[model samples]
Target: MPNWGEWAALAGGVPVTEERDPARDAARIEQLDPAYHHHDPSVPERIWDWIGEQLDKALGSVGVPASGISTVLLFVLVLVVLAGLLWWRLGAPRRAAGRAVALFGSGGPAGADEHRAAAAGHAAAGRWTEAVREQLRALIRGLEERTLLDVRPGRTADEAAAEAGRVLPEHAEALRRAARTFDDVVYGEHTADAGAYQALLDLDRAVTASRPTLAGSTS
Candidate 1:
């Protein structure tokens, strides 16, 4: 068979080093086929050429190993997964968490038109809870897209309000009050009527117009 150092170097686009260990590559060849050891020199050359082709293809699909692009890609994937997990564990705001939830949907959470249709469905069915839930969800989604507030259901209202306040201290009290109202209607024992719904709609609009800061606020 071919010299392991030459083959590995050809595959890796590196020079064969005299001090390099060849036993590992040799063992790999042995696993492929123990009979390969008996092959002629031409056979080993062809095999190395094939390995070179494969490495070339792998490199093209990604990039040169110089940038550690493959390693960085793996690291990025791991970081994305970890970030998603952290958002989940920390009870990211409804808006923030929806990003993860959207992954479960066929084409992601329904678009605005779809949401409107769903809201209409809830309204037609007279399912106040469902209608309110849908509206609240839409509001949260809009806020997130606009970078107004990073709301998530897993996060408490106080936490969300605090975040909103930090992002827009000028509207902090208003945000806090709105959050309190939302909590009361959505989770409290009180029944939310048309007036409450209107109030929520108003709050959503106000928050949208606030031109709030980014989620990462110093306060």
Candidate 2:
């Protein structure tokens, strides 16, 4: 092999150089303008598109068109929303009625007056839970005494509220709330205060004072 300087001398003495053009580089950079670049879709748009794509795939599997699937889905969604609203508005009475059937056992108060006296005694001692229980009992017994509620075995507080609500429409809300309070204290193991006891007492008094409405009337 020839030596390094001898090889260079043997060949034409050519100096290597790198050629750069600022104008050409600038033109290349301008061609890559961010303003003209395509942007990824927004998060919500992407999600909606993904959902539509999935729906299309699913519908296509069943030989359904995407447009028809959209219409059907919209209808079903509207129906579900309306059903939820209706349930929110009208489900209370039915739930209260169901809860009532499970509130108490076979034995109940002998008389409304006796229960009232017991409730008063409990209130005097500041035993609000007992007071609430006895007052609710008084209300139930009072209804039974006046033949407002049938003498059914294993009556529950919620049941009594429902039955009395039928008889006394004006106190229906109060009756329902009072029954819930009683259940909270007894079954739910919640502590009752004076306010709870007073509410039940007021409900009892209202039920006793109100005259029963005609049968099968729920206003």
Candidate 3:
């Protein structure tokens, strides 16, 4: 019921009435107001906390330890950092070819050895398009040096392949294919890869070793 005195009064003829404080009720409403709730987080805080919660739920489902989750997050952050560093060092991967003109550009005429060296460098750097172009250049230049094909100014890839094919009849098809790859990378607005580069390199070696036969010769 109540304390001894209150119980005694209740047992007697006295009645008790509950009292309300209007000031206290107004203060409670003020405490619940959003603008006055300084302890609550802002929008950015809510977003960041939501991301962390999602990550925890995902990783926890895989039975990752709470500490291990941090480690995994740090590892992913490191990979992203390393990618940024690589882009800074080697530049971004291009969707289009280099801005140079096709087939030897405007530079002075380079020897077969020079072109081959350039192709090797590009291959090492994972620039397959440039590598393929340079290797094809080396193939044509080497044949010219060997007197298997004439070195004519302003000669195109198709013309060079046709002329060389006539002299090196056994490799005519290969030479034509190599020329097409060269044109695709350099002028036809296409890309190349490691396999294409390797093909051109093999063609160059084969053409260098083979003896040239005159056009229409049975030999």
Off by over 4 Å in 2: 1-109, 216-219
- Better candidate by lDDT, 1 or 2: 2
Per-residue C-alpha lDDT of model 3 across residues 92-201, encoded as one tens digit per residue: 44422343234556674389999999999999999998889889989998988888777775677777888899888889999988877776676545579999999999
User: Per-residue alpha-carbon lDDT of model 1 for 54-116, expressed as tens digits?
Assistant: 766787687666356457567868999999887654443644433323211234344433554
Number of the predicted model whose lDDT against the real structure is largest: 3
- Could you give the C-alpha RMSD of every candidate to the true structure, in order shown? 20.0, 9.4, 13.6
Between candidates 1 and 3, name the one with more favorable TM-score.
Answer: 3
Candidate 1 deviation (Cα RMSD): 20.0
**Model 3: which residue pairs collide?**
none
- Name the regions of candidate 3 deviating beyond 4 angstroms: 1-102, 215-218
lDDT of all predictions, in order shown?
0.59, 0.78, 0.82
Residue-wise C-alpha lDDT for candidate 2, range 32-95, written one tens digit per residue: 9976556868789999899888988998999997679889779889999999887654454545
Estimate the lDDT of model 2. Answer: 0.78
TM-score on alpha carbons, each prediction: 0.38, 0.51, 0.51
